[model samples]
Target: MAKLLVVGAGFAGAVHARELANAGHQVDVIDKRDHIAGNCFDYVHDCGVRIHRYGPHLFHTSNDRVVGWLSQFTGWLPYEHQVVALLDDGRKVPLPVNLDTINAVFGTRLETADDAMSYLASVALPRSPVISAEDHLYSTIGKELTDLFFRPYTKKMWQLDLSEMDAAVVRRLQIRTDRDPRYFRSDTFQALPTDGYTRAFERILDHDRISVRLTTSFSQDDMAGYDACFNSMPIDEFYEFDLGELPYRSIRFHVSHHLAATAEGLATINYTDAGPYTRETWWHALPGHRVHETSNVLRTIEEPCCYRENSLERYYPIKDRDLMYQSLYERYAARAATDDQMFFIGRCGTYQYLDMHQVINQSLVHVSKWIARS
Candidate 1:
């Protein structure tokens, strides 16, 4: 059996380690953080509320393979995430610009899906070839709604104007004619683990053939001992940034405790004003997170900043209309290709804004191919 090393105890590394170990390979997993689950890490607070250390992570995916695989470690709790955008006029409207949201915003008492579609079309500024996020938003919802909902949020989130960013950045969000208030509409499976995320990670990495080390950092020199390495470290850091730095946006979270039963009625609230803060999440609002005996609430507010400014804690990789960062990532990926033993996986390694299911799917595919080749 081959000895393999998996860096970063996130989904990518945990999936690889588990799969390899099941195949009779000896796997060692290491994470710089003291715990597993990466950004999905959560723990119960003193007041009995479960707090997601990073931000709120809602698991929603259409891939059956992903759902089937993760089900082995933990049972599922059905949770459809909902978000409301807090407008400047102190009005909360459903996000993704749905039928209800449109009526509420413009005081148009439209009823059917066709009515909503007609309304949007009347206001939309058609752009033949949309290249930037501003263009996409304008073409879909027009300048008024775009400025009211997206422009300021995008500015705070990416620290860049909408016109400067790629269209793909905003394309993930859907503008629905139906009054579907759920954040993720297309996903077949939208739920959280029955237990906490940390417990699920514990079960995933509990194989006899696999061992994990927490509060440990991975170095290039450590690669000499293992036959193969599945690394989730930042690709630029792995290469020591020889080709220069790739830009990433990070969040500085400020969590506060309240003696109330709930903060807002919704689980998440997006700020539409030109403030430093972007969004806030109410921990107790989520299913499987509320404690019956406790009357306290934990709210986390997010402020976006550069990864460098946030002590190198990278969350979202910045993608611009110019594609400069993508080109830089390609250079690093080319260098990674030369090392046959080293494989880069996860958001930081691939330099893409990936969801939890996408990361798991990628690791599953990669490990299967690697095992077959071996």
Candidate 2:
């Protein structure tokens, strides 16, 4: 069996370490943070509420294999995620801009789904090769909807104007036709672990063959002990950013608790027009779960300025032609590939956004490839 080092105790690294160790390989897992789960970290807050330390990570994947694998760790909790947008006029509309949202916001009833689609198509900009998020909304959805929803939210999410980014980003979220409030197809039947996500990681990392070290950093000097290393932390930070640091966006949570029976009538609420925050979520809003009446609300604010530091825990990678993120990523990816048996995994390692289920799926795929190579 090969000796392996897995960096970062997030889903990607944890899964990799567990798989390798179970296969009789000596595995060492390390994380700079004092925890196993990365951004999916959750624990009881100061007020005794079950708080998602980073943000709400609703585990939803249509992949049956992923579901089967996760089922081995924890029982499933059925939940349907519903999000709404708060308007200036005290109106709350379903998110993803459904038919209900358009009817309520416009105050003019469109008779049918076809009618709404026709209205949108009529107002849409003439065929253009490409546009920015600002351009797509301004040219099609009109100023009212664009300004009220897309503009401010984009700024809060990326700390950049809608015009600064590609139109595809906004297009992916907008829907002018009549439809149900479910945002994505994969989330039709959402699933959350009954015991919380961290417990699953703790159990997975419990194998004697795998040694976990929290609040620890891995050094190149330790490279001698392992025949292979899986680096799941940021690609830039792993190499000390020899090719220059990549840009990223960060988040700030503005949480407060009040003795209440239920939340503010939203699983997630978007304050799109303007603010330090764009979205707010309550984890207890999910169905088939017992919520504590005395628990506090967990609200999050997107702070674009939190990503200035080179080692500030990069969450969202900045993607733009001018940013040259791919160019810089290539430098580190090339290094990892050429450096003997070392392998890069996960979003930070591969420089791409991936869901928790995706991270696990990717790790499983990597294990198969490793086995074949061996």
Candidate 3:
């Protein structure tokens, strides 16, 4: 059996470790944080409600393989996420500008999908080539809607103008003309872990061949005993920013245990304009949790900020059109390519904005191939 070191005990590292251990490999997983689930970590609040420590992670994926794999660890809780946007006009409407949102925001009697389509056609401005996020949104939704809905939100999230970012960053969002208020409807599996993400991680990592070290820092010297290293740390940090540090946006969650049930009807509400924070999430609304009568509910307001090296934890990676940063990442990637035994696999490792399922899928694919070769 080969000895392997997996860094960052999140989805990528855990999945790789589990898969490797199952294949009769000795795997050691280390995390800088005290917890195992990384950003998907959740803890039961004193109030009895389970709170997602780093924002709400709603798991919904079209991949059956991913669904099947994760199902082995935890049972599913049916949860189709719904989000609302608090506009500048003090109006709350469904996000992604759906049929009800159009009626609520514009005060129009649009009943059918055809009416919604007609309205969008009337307002949406046609752009020749949509290269940036600004161009993509403006071309699809028009000037007014873009300014009200997307412009301020995008600025707050990434701290950059939409024109400065690649279109792929913005293209991930879906704009619907139907009455579907759910945030993600296209995914076939829409649910959360019945126990919580942390418990799910515990189940996955409870293998005899796997050893976990929490709050641990690793250096090049630690890689000596291991046959291979799977890194989920930031690529720039691994190289010690020899090239300029890549830009990322970090978030701070202001959590409050409410004495009463949450007033916010939806799971999350986005403050589109005139707010220090980007959005607020109510935890009680999500599936799979027992809230005792004495404990009340838990809610959080998410504030996005420019990433500080030592002060805060990096949450979201900024996808921009900066040639210098791109070139720097390419240099690191080239180094990884040269080292066949080292693998960079995850959101931070790959340095792209990815959802939970995408990360799981990548780990499964790459680790399977890696095992086959070994």
| lDDT of the candidates, in the order given | 0.91, 0.76, 0.85
List the candidate 2 regions with Cα displacement exceeding 4 Å: 46-48, 127-129, 186-189, 287-302, 309-311
The most accurate candidate by TM-score is 1
> Over the stretch 1-374, how does candidate 1's per-residue lDDT look in tens digits?
99999999999999999999999999999999999999999998888888899999999999999999999999988999888999878989999789999998889999999999999989999897998898998998898889988889888987789988788888987888999998888899999887789899999999999999999999878878799999999999988889999888999999998876446767899998999998999888888887455878889999999988998899998777778899999999998899899999999999998999999999999999999998
| Candidate 1 lDDT trough over 10 residues, lowest sum | 258-267
Model 2, position 84: C-alpha lDDT score: 87
For candidate 2, report its TM-score: 0.92
State the lDDT at 372 in candidate 3. 98
In terms of lDDT, which candidate is stronger, 2 or 3? 3
What digit string (tens of lDDT, one per residue) describes model 2 on residues 138-243? Answer: 6777676777777888777777788788887777665747667875544544777777878888888889899988898878887787788888877788788878
Estimate the TM-score for candidate 3: 0.94
- What TM-score against the true fold does each predicted structure earn? 0.96, 0.92, 0.94
Instruction: Please write out the lDDT profile of model 3 over residues 1-374, one tens digit for every residue.
Output: 89999998999999999999999999999998889999999998888888998899999999999999999999988988888998777788899789998888777899899998899888888887988888888787778778888878878877777788777777877778889988888889999898999999999999999999999976878899889999999988888888768777888889987756435556799888846688998887777655554547878998888779426577777655756666777888988899977899898888877899999999999999999999
Q: lDDT winner between 1 and 2, please give it.
A: 1
